[model samples]
Target chain A: MAQPNPHNTYLPGYKEVGHHEWRTAENSAPYLLPTLQSLAETNPSLTLLDVGAGSGTITTSLAKYIPQGHITAIDLSPDILSRAASHAASVNATNITFQPASVYELAQTFGPAAFDVVHAHQVLCHLDAPVQALAQMLAVVKPGGVVAVREIDMRVWSFHPFSETMRAWVEVQKATHAAAGGSNEAGPSLVAWAMRAGARREDVKASMGTWLYATEEERRVWGTSFRDRIVGGEMRKKALELGIATEAELDRMGEEWQRWMETEDACCGTLHGEILIRKPK
Target chain B: MAQPNPHNTYLPGYKEVGHHEWRTAENSAPYLLPTLQSLAETNPSLTLLDVGAGSGTITTSLAKYIPQGHITAIDLSPDILSRAASHAASVNATNITFQPASVYELAQTFGPAAFDVVHAHQVLCHLDAPVQALAQMLAVVKPGGVVAVREIDMRVWSFHPFSETMRAWVEVQKATHAAAGGSNEAGPSLVAWAMRAGARREDVKASMGTWLYATEEERRVWGTSFRDRIVGGEMRKKALELGIATEAELDRMGEEWQRWMETEDACCGTLHGEILIRKPK
Candidate 1:
């Protein structure tokens, strides 16, 4: 069992029902090559852990990739964890198990030297103590095992058919992250944070990956997901409470997303930082 | 013979020695997959044209990829063309030939339907008349063949260890492009430009690519290349003439590049837009 950290406040909160659709295991394809290679080198039956396993999209997807390997997918909210468990069941991902856990409790809950691989995607930026959380993660991974993390740098997000409303939307996102006391643009600092968490300089390797929305289908899917997250999700309430944007302003951004979807030649690209840290034997 | 367009002025001009090392065929790899597939489907002996082919790096590299195919590599400056020709010889690229030509002359110089494929890399954004040039490129490609173009969008370039001088460096680059009457951030509009250039809306496909410099070697190479471009290249004289930046400011930027090279965890990513338009049969 794990207890949630009282200090953590997540942005675009987990209550956003449709938010996870935008972050499927497919969205995480770029970060998986090295890990998949590692899995191949190791045994297929090795244990892996997924921290902050939102919606179980990536967790369930990983079940398919390593059918024989067992995965412990943990998150803080039982409500979200149950939902993710249901999703996993629906997808027939039997190799994955769920737990209500927080980043702060990972080492204690799982014990030391547990997982062969520890992976997190888009989770660190939302945590209040990412470096501390990383240290805990490092503790749970076996000596000589690897911990992989991927984070987005919204500062570099580029979108086509520029609109003032869209620009404000990006700013509001950054503000909301600040209001929640987390770093939204944490991609560039992953390597530095790993070092601060006690990983040696030589133990960390960094690379960049990208997310692009260009095709009509991709644009529509992304636009709808974001619009829903802002309009009907907890994000709308939080933003208004934080005074990041007015209700009417949020509504306008929602409308702008639909317009962006319809506009031909619309495109958006976001860069993500990937870090692989090896625990010394 | 092809004549240079009198109205055109290129930023970071061709006379910048060592500039071509940064843009080898490997740099253009992302844009080549579809084009390479097209080449494979077509006859191996089909003709290809490289407009604004700089340094003969991409041109000569392509020669090896398709040994039976022939490449006509064109640029505006005879001096640069001679250098590229010498480079091609040094590489022993037997299938490539260099020509001193401007984008404006492609149609008349090649005649209608002269080649199976036409490609341009980082060229359209610098041209005075990109749409006309694209239209000409379309006219020269065989019916059912493709015209591929790639342009950088500097507005979204992101770098780590942020400094005021580095920000100024990016702004000065945009300023120089503006002074030369070119669109520095032309990436997002690539699809629109292609449509305006006479391709039907449905005939064009757009994708985004990225350039990342993260490793120690990559940081040093990129930093050195830009420092040289700012210090000893034609760009320095042109920026001064255009009043884009003072000599002293440019020198400070050059020094900042050296500092950035030495800084650990330095990373930069630049996004580019790629377009492929198919001619109607």
Candidate 2:
């Protein structure tokens, strides 16, 4: 019999929720596109690998940029990969392929020196061994190719007219993630992780970016998504099981989220740490 | 005909950049100590007022569990107020007075209601009104009392694996502080500032805290000091002259400081947004 995986608590819901909220142009382009453009500038017909390619929103977008080139989108969830495949087909993005694979097993499955660029966004923070995953990412990228990673530095998450409910929610989220052996600190630590994973320090180019949800519509989307995640998703169950928050507290936080969404001047956003490293030729 | 104020550039190097290094057990204790104790169930006698009491590393320590007490330390840079009077006479302390006025004249120099608790740390974020200097520290406190403020949201200052000469330093540091005519995003936008200045939000209790450099001598200080002010303070001059980085850009950031310090695993600290507003009894 197969043993149950402890960290699997949050993954099932994450796949069903689909990451479509993050798929919007407003969220993805500011950080992902620039790195892709920079790489495209160097090799117009590059072959790229999109690791943890959630719903293929970013992958298909990258496919459009490299019309003559190709992209292989991979993920651990077959459900997400199926959705990603459907998304690629809907977009008529022919230059991409979708696969099911874990980032840790990438080198073994794809062979070494297989990609011109390897990219992942908001992914590594959820991995138990981000550095090892980076090593795998590095292994599959050809010499002189680029490996780009972007993750949110949760410490920078802030909002105006502070909310205690939001604060408690953030605490619960962090504790749940930590209990699952993941990190919210992954974003700011990207460069350090890359260097530790065998990339030379001098070869890493680090930058910071943000996703601001300030306008009414944007805030509605952001707040509602978070409210659903907290009140309706498995996160609430995971949090309770972990003893990170009681049900009453979670209910209070959900109400707080509703109140926050209704506040006129309310705005919130997150910071992302981005890094682009060139594999030594 | 008036001579230009030399200190206008950055407050004459903030006499207590000593607060920047945060090396002593005494320095870290004040801010962290009281908050923890307050969460405990106790009456905690505290007749306090710490107006711009720079480096009074003791105001907060005294705030902890003072069952029958008073504390009033004020400052407007008298030579006697040097380094917050040697951090309250280097520990052999007695609750006392150190006054000099001007938190917008302070209810005609401490007249109305005069105390139960009226505190300020890193006061008024350089006050261009400062909600009428927090309505003169809420008309000198005591109709249910408790007025506290702490600021500094240095979100635009960044350095990476050590930028050759701190590239973005001059641009961001100046724009953020200058944009507000004060601080980038001083602590929680003082509730008293809101209530006194006619913001619709009701008075609310808010608290924010931060980690400071303690051990690991190499990480001893990761904050801007007057030394940086005196020697490398061209940021003020550059911001005014070039206008390369906009006020909008400065307003959007609050993560740069965290990223820079973490790169070297260097110890750094931030003053947090804290507010405690008590409704009339």
Candidate that scores best on TM-score: 1
Cα DockQ of the candidate 2 complex: 0.05
iRMSD values, candidates in order: 1.9, 8.5
- Candidate 2 per-residue lDDT over residues A1-281, each given as its tens digit: 22222243224355244335356433554445666677787788889999888888888877877887899998878887888888889989999888887788777889999999899987888877888888889999999888888777655555665667777888888887776678767865787788789987667776555565544566677777777768877778889888878888998888887777786545565656777888999
Clashing pairs in 2: B151-B187, B155-B254, B188-B273
Q: Which runs in model 1 stand beyond 4 Å of their true positions? A: A1-6, A14-19, A24-26, A200-202, A228-251, A279-281, B1-6, B14-19, B38-42, B230-251
* CA lDDT, candidate 2, residue B261: 39
Top lDDT prediction, candidate number:
1
Task: Give candidate 1's TM-score.
Answer: 0.88
- Give residue B13's lDDT in candidate 1 (0 to 100): 64
lDDT of 2 by residue, B1-281 (tens): 22222222224244335544343223433343454256223445556677766566646365434535667787666653565556666764556567765676767777877876676765677656677777667777777665656554455222233342343554455463555467555554554354655433445444444333312332324433422432335444445355755443332222343344334432233334555555364
Clashing pairs in 1: none
